[model samples]
Target: MANTSADDLLRTARELFAVDGYQATSIGHIAEAAGLSKSAVLYHYASKEALLDAVLAPAEAGLAAVLHRFPQASDGNRAEFVEPFVDFLLAHRLEASIFINQGQSLHGIPVIDRANQLVQQLAHAVSSEFGSIADRVRFGVALGGAAYILAAQENWADPDDEPERDDEVRAALVDVVATLLTTTSTGIAATRGD
Candidate 1:
């Protein structure tokens, strides 16, 4: 049941961090939310930052796993990475929201810095595959749009507990991002000069 307690603390921490803002959230708040004593929260996480780290660790690993497929992307197998990318974003919405909403202000924090690095790496990996600046822009738009959509939802106080909703959103996001990645530049992106 130790795993269950840790999971509860992580979940509570994530929701509180997203809803209350990370700086405003305290270890006590997480403990109270998880229906545990402060010492119990401490048993799982030495500090609020440790709790944040736990919440973000899976997302970091997930993004890294997605990045590992970038070589396949260069070989015209970009489709192989799209679903995993979306799945990572959907699975780590709260962590993404922390970066989206609080990253700049939280600079110098190791986890946030590492998260930013992963995002930059993702951009470089995606952009390096295509020649045109326009393709790079498409990559940026697709990534930015997907991240924004997932992160924005965390602002809602209501928890994301709906599997059907998750499935629908996940499918739509995968389709949209996959289509964007695959489509040839035919719009302003095509015509614009580098």
Candidate 2:
């Protein structure tokens, strides 16, 4: 290909890896898909793994941004803590395929580690309103399920297109999380004289 940018290569690589499985997607395949030579792809990314990293960078950044906002978002404004994250995960469903198809393959990678850490951060954010063990467990399950379902849910359209149930899913997700937080807050108040 002529004058293909690194981002163009990353977009092509994400498509290939999403459709072809990361294990099956080779540098050559990505190059051909991008209309570039294998060497051209290599010039920008040292390896297929590096290309995968580049492709997944946005998802990582999105989660990190959400984590950054956790401290400032109050319990009552739970949507402030959850909607951006739901949107982030939904937008990056293709990247989630790597986790679906290659679980252990990415175990020790920093990206995976950071994702786990973000999950913990989410747990902490949602649980910040209540100190009870039950509330912690409940919020952890609620937030974790919200993230997982968006990332792994069945796509009802072309893989390249956004999921058709965007508003439905977003509303249901926020509703569930709000219910969890409200229930926990009410319980804490009833029990602790708040």
Candidate maximizing lDDT: 1
Task: Tell me the deviation in Å of residue 173 in model 1.
Answer: 0.7
Candidate 2's TM-score: 0.65
Candidate 2: regions farther than 4 A off: 1-5, 72-79, 96-105, 128-154, 157-165, 176-194
For model 1, residues 1-194, the per-residue Cα lDDT tens digits are 38887788888888888768899998888888898999988876778888888888888888888888664464366766788888888888878778655777888878989988888887676555567777777787788777777766544536756434778889988898887787656544565852
> Which window of ten consecutive residues has the lowest lDDT sum in model 1?
155-164
lDDT of each: 0.78, 0.70
* Model 1 error, position 135 (Å): 6.0
Error of 1 at 56 (Å): 0.8
Model 2 Cα lDDT, one tens digit per residue, 1-194: 44447668888887777667777889999888887899998887888877877887787777778778776556566667667766766777666555434444667766665666665676666666677777876776675566556645664346886765788887887778777755675676788998
